[model samples]
Target: MQETILNIYLVIDKGSVTSFRAKAYEMEGEDSAKIGFLKERATEDFASAFVFDSPKNKKGEYMPYKKFSKLEKQGLQYQLFEEIFEKFRVPQNPLICVTPVVDGEVFGKK
Candidate 1:
């Protein structure tokens, strides 16, 4: 059996006004590629707050909440990505990265 790979790109504008653009592609390969991309306007007011909300260990290290034989990280990434997308009303597509640059600074991606 062969595997299919998907790539996504997201262009976000969080300066003065908020906007988003998305692109996707599909390919055949054994390994998958990055799922998301971020592009922000040249302004300090815009910040990226979307991140994989994973569990942390006692030592302040990030860890997966569950175990999986394959695509665990990818799954988690998608899950978190979806959460942000839904919150911001981003479009959905396979093999694409949806980058969102929002207003304000809220630092924390785990």
Candidate 2:
């Protein structure tokens, strides 16, 4: 398909996790595109406390819990997780990022 850059927002409300995906550069604004999650995570930790990688051994270094995938940040799953936890405490600062998805997975900001 087309190499469309997608801007995604991760929001968690009332314990329910939901993802929002919008066209990176659209006249209609950030609400023009569809909203969803990327089951397929990323290879980098974009700004997460859970995901940490050590250049030496890429195995042990990973997301917060074993439940999370190693590649959750380069992707946007990290943001999603953060939003969910925040919602549990007091939801605020929805995470966002721009990236080209893999058959629709993302995080390669422009």
List per-prediction Cα lDDT, in the order shown.
0.33, 0.32
Instruction: Name the Cα RMSD for model 1.
Output: 12.1
Model 1 lDDT, full chain set: 0.33
TM-score of each: 0.27, 0.23
Clashing pairs in 1: 7-95, 7-96, 8-96, 8-97, 9-97, 10-99
Q: What are the runs in model 1 whose C-alpha is more than 4 Å off?
A: 1-61, 64-76, 94-110
Reference-based TM-score, model 2? 0.23
Where model 2 places Cα greater than 4 Å from the true spot, the runs are 1-3, 26-110
Pairs with backbone N, CA or C atoms under 3 Å apart (clashes), candidate 2: 42-71, 44-74, 99-108, 101-105, 102-105
Summarize candidate 2's per-residue lDDT along 1-110 as a digit string, tens digits: 22222334322223222233332322222422322222122223223313212121265432232222334535544454443344333224332343333322344432
Cα RMSDs of all predictions? Answer: 12.1, 13.3
TM-score of 1: 0.27
lDDT of 1 by residue, 1-110 (tens): 32222222222223321222222223344333232211222222123323323334697654322331133355644653454455445446434333333343322122
Candidate 2 global CA lDDT score: 0.32
